[model samples]
Target chain A: MKASLTLGKVTNFLGLGFFITLKDLFTGKLEKEEFKNFLRKTIVPLVSILLFIGLWHLGAKSLYNIEAKFKIEKALQDQGQVAADALKTCMVSGESSCQPNTLPSPSQVWNSFQSLLRDHNIISADKAAFIEKTAAMNEKRVAAGKAAIVYTGRPSFVDQVFTSLQTVFAGFLLALLIAVPLGIFIGLSPNLKSAFNWFIQIFKPVSPVVWYLLVFMIVKTLLIGSTEDSSFTISFISVGLCSMWATLVNTAMGVSTVDKDYINVAKVLKLGTFQKIFKVVLPSSLPLIFTGLKITLSVAWMVLIAIELLAQSPGLGLFVWEEFQNGANDSNAKIIVAMFAIGIIGFLLDRLMLMIQNWVSFDKTDAI
Target chain B: MAYLELNNICKTYGQSDGETEVLSNINLKIEEGEFVAIVGFTGSGKTTLVNLINGLIKPTSGTVLFKGEPVDGTSHERGVIFQNYSLLPWLTVGQNVFMAVKEAFPKKNKKELHEIVANYVEMVSLTPAINKRPNELSGGMRQRVAVARALAMKPEMIIMDEPLGALDALTRGNLQDEILNIWGKDKRTALLITNDVDEGIYMADRIIPLRPGPNATLGPEFKIDLERPRDKTEMNDNPNFKKTRNEIIEYLMDIGNERKSEAKEEYILPDLVPKDFVNQFKFGR
Candidate 1:
């Protein structure tokens, strides 16, 4: 009886093991297929980037003399050390004394990030207490820093990224608000179209920097007056004006490109204004409109970065500028890393916009 | 009173150097439930006449009365099937038909609307491909969808502008039969624009020839006077069908010969003009 019971237990264990292995195999197959698709989409781009990095590293190592190469390697090593020391000190003593002049390496930034995550309460505690003490102080700060980047001198890469993203989105949204209806008006009526044609022709070729400057000046004169900190106002105005042009041009073109047959169909049906736009015009023009939007979004991103760099606003552009200004010492390697991070973030932002365009795009077969 | 009337219609295009005329003195009265076929050669203003009736374009001098009212623009009362198969590419066959049905019967419940569309689609034998888009469909299928869409509306008048002109011989025969079968049941007032004499004889109560241009006009109307439900093979044997087909073909052949002579005269003009100028001027000198 004892032997039989033991044998039965052993068989059950084996069965369970087999079942677990089967489940794992199924899951592994699914994951592998998904990963393969992902790789198919990204492999060419990844290989190209790796090749570029390899070439860059090779050039730096081989083209430069031994001493020059050593200097760069030592600087990079020093940056790593600084990051480790800063992280160690922050963890041990609950404070950071790292200077802004010295750029932090990847490891240093990671360490700082880990420390910030741990001590989030410490940063917010004083503010919470201050808010309880004086509500007016919170309002003043909120108003002042609402548009500005609310970062300490030692801001994380995420803070910079989030700030830039917020600015770009805000400007893009504002551009859409201004452009779409105007575009429709222009597209529908000959009089409106003729009136706007000259304006479009004149303004379309104008540079974004020119638009930025003009808008900045106008906003300053009209609303804010001469203020020491006009960074936020200037950044918003410049980005908004620059991005708005693309959306306006695209929206008008999209609406105009709608099939004439659809218009006749609308007339035959006697669809109401709203119904006509929603049912006929909008669907027909969707492909063009989405393409326009893609172009507009990319332009908005580029404009936001330009404005941030030029205006000294808080964003990845500003972060890059600050790192570059800190000199060709140990921080140069950190600046290069920041450049890579910026590129990756921009690529991701473009892809996100592409996904959105895909989501909203009318199925090609559905077009009348 | 005529269900639709065209009184002394005329259309002239330009004023000066490049003056062109499309149609002149077109007069016709279509009774309710009458099927009329207007046959013409290419660029013979067959389309122009239909467009005037559909109110896509207006005559330079005349009026079109629909049910005792002036026809202004496109309406649900008159459904037009264009030669190009204007089935909204984005919509499926069912949806294309449903769109017309929905517009015509806005108050209809979903079930009623679906039934009406399905009935029309099935009438054209497109039930299997009802969910397919125009692009997904064959040319014949797409044209059938267009036909189904028109018929589903249950319009007072159906205007077909060479709707099956693009189809192959087999598909054309099939669609022609399908259209005739559908028309036989309801007897809706239909004006078919086609170049095919056999098609006119098979489908229409009366066949009218549109003469070739520099201002095309309607030739003498020929009444089919044959029995209902025309069979393609049997109609060939029918004496009336043969007589009418031959008469129409002979008339077209005469016009074709006249056009060729005119083209020959045009080619000969340049050479003769120089010789005539030299003789006249030299004699005067």
Candidate 2:
């Protein structure tokens, strides 16, 4: 019993308490108070979400009825008595007849999620089959001193998710690369800070769409003759430019406001300029810089959709846009699924950054 | 020859409009392995003087020489213990001391350096919390880490700027004894800057009073001739301790009175309840 208790304690400390708490509750080992606390934390949120879905379901059903009525009235006006009776039959026939273009039910969205997963799997299998079918031809071409043909099919939904992840990461990395050194440079000297201040102020508030246009123009010019796709480069540059300001501003602020005593400590230690910066300034300013980076990452994710939509890039953003334009029977439901996916992914990304920030920072207050 | 020397040191803040002279025409010399404390009220430029000695800041005029060499900038020869406990919050107590030890003795191997850090941490009885960050430690513990970090560097001289001023009385006295114990072992040249007169008398061989600013200067030096390893409670009974304490307090009081009179020179009365009402009240109308 003692051993099990210790194990429970260890798991709790490691933040893997959910499973252990569940097990303990089921096994009648958990105290009554703890079980109450667990229910309050977990079941409360679940019940609220269920309630939200119920309201959406009711609202959607009413909207669907309204749309059916509108279609009936329109048919009666266009084709007189005969069309009115036919439209009445269509409404009564339900699944076998015309369905109104209204908000999808919760079940429809769930079915869409499952269908997208199935589609992703089927598309992946098709790609595999295509690759296998082309293998012999490709081998012959390689032997005949010709380059092998590459598969150029549309990306699956899962593939699009990965593409969005990759794009955002690339953009975030580029932003960090540009912002940190620039921040340090501006932070170190008042002259440099003042020199860059006007440029920063003018450019910082410009929208990502404007940035995308500027990047697109430059990239189109540079890659005019090149066969390489320029969308990735254009989107990344725009994302980097739009998102870097938060990090840049925060890093400069953090660096400039580092405590004077720490600076004095550096001096008393006779630390060289390089050592002082790396040891004192950077470490001290890291909490604020991390905060900026978190903001920049979220900004990058937010800006990515517009860039992808405009650039016609293959990512989740483009996926959402394409689904909206598709306007098929299930497209609305698929779009709803995508919306939830984006929100959940954004929340997860923020949580991931928070975990890293907490790990790096000595101050526990920065955890939130 | 003095281990550290300040010849006609002067420091001024700003220029042209609103120029304030913090220190003026200060001359001091300290022999090798001597512990000296400069005591004064707040804004008396004791910190500025300590900064000058540590080479963290420069004197606007006059030369500060360490071992007959003119101080141009900061060096590893002087290590300072700041009042605010200048341990990097991100670094553990051990790491804070290790950083200084590593900087001071770059040639020392990793194991040897670790030993140095551990030794000093143990000196302050913070061995258990050596791996803890500054935020996790109490104020006294944080200050102890600061002390350990400064001492671990093993600088030629130690400069403390009110190191224990923020700590409670019990913690302050305990740390004072710990510091004295460490000092007794090596007898390194040390200068403590503080406003507490008794703290100066207890810790240093000589206590120097810095008169109130603006343009604060050293007033007089009171030597504490009490025996080594002095007991805090027993010091109350010691005649020499009483004499030194009285002398320093009397000097401080005189300077305090002088400052009050000087402030009165530029005094102006407010028109509270009207001047006529005050005159009427005075005349019992």
Candidate 3:
């Protein structure tokens, strides 16, 4: 009985109740109905994923063959039958340059992912060695009042990912700082709401490219002779401007809809204006504010790539653009790898926001 | 001068031609340390009157004077317990009560404030769940916390608007007794707005009915002569309780029936029936 109790606790803690159900079914301790549910939840999805990959592989193969045939035919028409035959032989032998530039196979994308990992490992080792070798030198320079020499090597894939995360977080903070207070002020009075409505409507739908350009134009003049690189500032600011509308709108909506009874309570307490906002207004509207924040974070992340690419910042967006331009045999595979990484990271960020929203919001009607 | 007075108060919603007059010609005076309950049916502008007294809202054309001073806005002296338990969902019961006490007694140190919060929370028998959020508690428990919060402020006048209407019978009975017990200790000025006639008769020195509305106004007041420390079980057998209850209920019934009869309209049915339906009925098809 104690063991079963502990198992139940563990199931609740880790959301692993299904695994126990599966174990029970396999051990003949489950009912037929329970076993069927296990299959429906767990097994069907696995089969569907395999089916998806199989279709992708077939499609990739057909596209490769079509391109290869087209290349050979063009060679024959341009030169001679001998040249066509030589090109076919090169393609059949799987020479790197002769490979058709098209949608990469699943295995090729997997290999590219592994290669990127290996490159990150190598670059990390290089960085560690360089730091060690220059530790004494850097110290000497500091003592002599001279600048320290730093590593000038290109950032690895993992470094780029971290840079992107840092930029997105900065952007998300910026958006929250600008939107929430403005939204509250607008929500408090009808006059303010009407006055600001036109501004928000006009700017909310502006594209990321235009926002980036606007930031760039202003930041360039503002940072005049400063030696610091301003791409990070520009990229994050543009991201913030592009993504803040959802948070602003949702916060205003939430604040305006607070229950009248709660307002009355605040009034009867004789709370000051700021106290009313902090104690009564903010707490009541937090669920909607969090929903807005979730949307803002996702939008920040989506616009971050384009802004980074435009600013030429060292992040995933720049990395993807560079890979596309490099035109190497494995570049397509590497780009596909980055695409998957971006999708998975976006999903993870959303879940993180959801977890935070649940923690702060007193509404428990929905668990997740 | 009375402790609280409302003079020729009128309240309306909307503008000009589209106006809805919720309350009209409302005037009342309550002496210091008097307990009064205003009973009305739902949507009879009982809340508007309460809001006017507490200074959460202003009357369109009349005066609300508290302690002979014009009521301009809300004050800690008039603590209101709203119908819906407006406990901030994010804050625990201890924190909700603590915030009010802190606001009411800003000069009091943190220790004194905490003591007050703890005392009231214990008064409502919610000491075990002081750290619980409103969502975690039952409806009755939430209302109890709201009570604890309002009373902890040490308001001179406690204004309650149908606070126990949403609760079931057992919780309501328990809360009514608890409120009475607290009021018995010090006869603070209190006003309760409710739809329940019995609740008014049991709790107050005087019971006043708010007539039903298009422009609802105050009806005649019923004076309750029940003795102090009123017993709930004994209340069922008391002659005065039955008489007052019957009188209030009958007056309300008369108001309802009068309104219905006035609204009763005659409708003449169209003098034609469908030819096919008539033929089918005659042939019994």
Candidate 4:
């Protein structure tokens, strides 16, 4: 009886009871208390999110209208008759005023998302028609052993997302290729670590913008005589350089601090140098290396926007910059839409890395 | 010729200020198929001696010979069961054993390798947990995996460094019997390092006491002439067991007393005088 009681307590402590309650609720056998608890758990977060959106809807209107109007009036009130006429037009027409440009409410952002999707559909149709018209000519060119003409239309919102993903992954791959071996080398030899330490320290904290400029200079020179696009290469290289430090530092630390016992085991087993590293050192240090990779990936993503914008690479960053420059009434709303898209994608990327980390790591609890 | 030999082995650790000698003038020889146990206190450098035998570490000055050849780097011929379970955490129990088997017998087919791993894992009675990783295992279970991994490698000699030190008494006894059972067949040359005197006598053909360190060395060896398949219950009443136990205890006690006095001698306070000593003259040194 005591054992059963203890088991019951343990199960309850681990919240196994909550799952049982959920099962019963689904089966229409839940008791009053359990039903209430289930509803609280499920419905509360939803309700809170709705409440938050509602608050945002109200707050954005009041903040944008009054603040933007005040700024415009204060700036233009001292000018002249022309300024007075412009101010009158701005105050009379909501879209003509600066308020809509400053802060777009939830409804406006939602409308902008819908319009962007519509624009994407139209552009996609146009691209399809262009491809169909060019198919015969392109086929003839292919038969003649010449390259076909490529589509040169402006990328849509969705296309920009794909471009951003491509850039970040390319950059992350390059970082991994460079950092892991360099880290292992530095970690294995104290002399090498000391030799590289000054370089790492000097360059690790250099801003992504500076890295972009440096990469842009080199890539521009390399591509000056070539007709191919250099923006993608420049942006990716900059992203890779900017994010390489995290992986390098973490990998080195991981390799250097591997448990001495594991190394001793490798010795006793008489494992070859290659076998020892691949079978022991790498596996043991994987958790730290993975942590570094996750950080590197996120950093690569965070700076990819700035890199893309500066380099004029086709990505979400460029989309945001273009919209900001457009400064139309709906441009502000579209930019807001892009911001949320970036945030959501960033969150999903992190989750993807976490999933992979958990899958590979033996110590699953320590993955995060 | 002895299967393994350690001649005048000495090890010193260099500190920032000075060198602290851990083991000095250590000499031992184990004949073929002999089970030897070295018993010592926690700080008596038992692990250092084990490392020396396993070729994991080099003695500051001396020679370690295996079958008349001087020990250099580690070789697959000498298998070690570490005090801490050194089974790779990422590898499953079967995979852990398989890794060693693969290394030792690289020419073996995949099926043959799997059989070797399965056989060892079964020997340790961890067949059910073949797929489970190290972190999922209990402490005792993990050590059993380590044991299986080391044994599966089929080394000519085995070195166990406090293999059961962290286990509960019942688990320790269980593993001790398991080791002895494995040792009975073919009786490969083996060395067991332990702090437990009873355990040393119970498992080994001969029990050698290692004196506490700061230049610690082997004291004496006691031979256990008990019959095969010794039962713990019967050993309690056996005269030979009693005699061996008492002899080891007495020798260890003598070393403890000697070390205690040496420590006491080193604890002498420094003599110093300050201008304010007159104020506390009653307590002045």
- Please report the candidate that would top DockQ against the real structure: 3
Candidate 4 docking classification: medium
The residue ranges of model 1 lying beyond 4 angstroms of the native Cα positions read A1-50, A61-63, A66-153, A225-230, A328-335, A363-368, B109-111, B264-285
- Best candidate, TM-score: 3
Candidate 1 lDDT (Cα, whole model)? 0.76
lDDT of 4 by residue, B7-122 (tens): 99999889657998899999999998999999999988999898888888899999999999999988889889999988888888888898889989999999999999999999
lDDT assessment of candidate 3? 0.90
Clashing pairs in 1: A366-B90, A367-B90
Q: lDDT tens digits, residues B1-285, model 2?
A: 788999998899999898999999898888889999999999888888888888778899999989999987877778889989888888889988998998999999999999999999999999999998899999999999999999998878889999999999999999999988888899899999998988988889998899877898888688889888888889999988888899899989998988788765665788676457777798985
Looking at model 2, residue A275 earns an lDDT score of 91
User: Which pairs of residues collide in model 2?
Assistant: none
- Give each model's whole-structure lDDT: 0.76, 0.88, 0.90, 0.88
Query: Which of candidates 3 and 4 reaches a greater TM-score?
Result: 3
Alpha-carbon error at A215 in model 3, in Å?
A: 1.4
Q: Which tens-of-lDDT digit does each residue in A65-176 have in candidate 1? A: 4433454456557777665555445435634332223334444544544554445455456545654665666577778875432324344556677888888888777778
* Over 4 Å off, model 4: A1-55, A68-100, B265-285
RMSD of each: 12.6, 4.9, 3.2, 6.9
Per-residue lDDT tens digits of candidate 1, residues B82-201?
878776766778987887788889999999999999998998999999888788889999899889888888888899999999999999999998888888888889999999988898
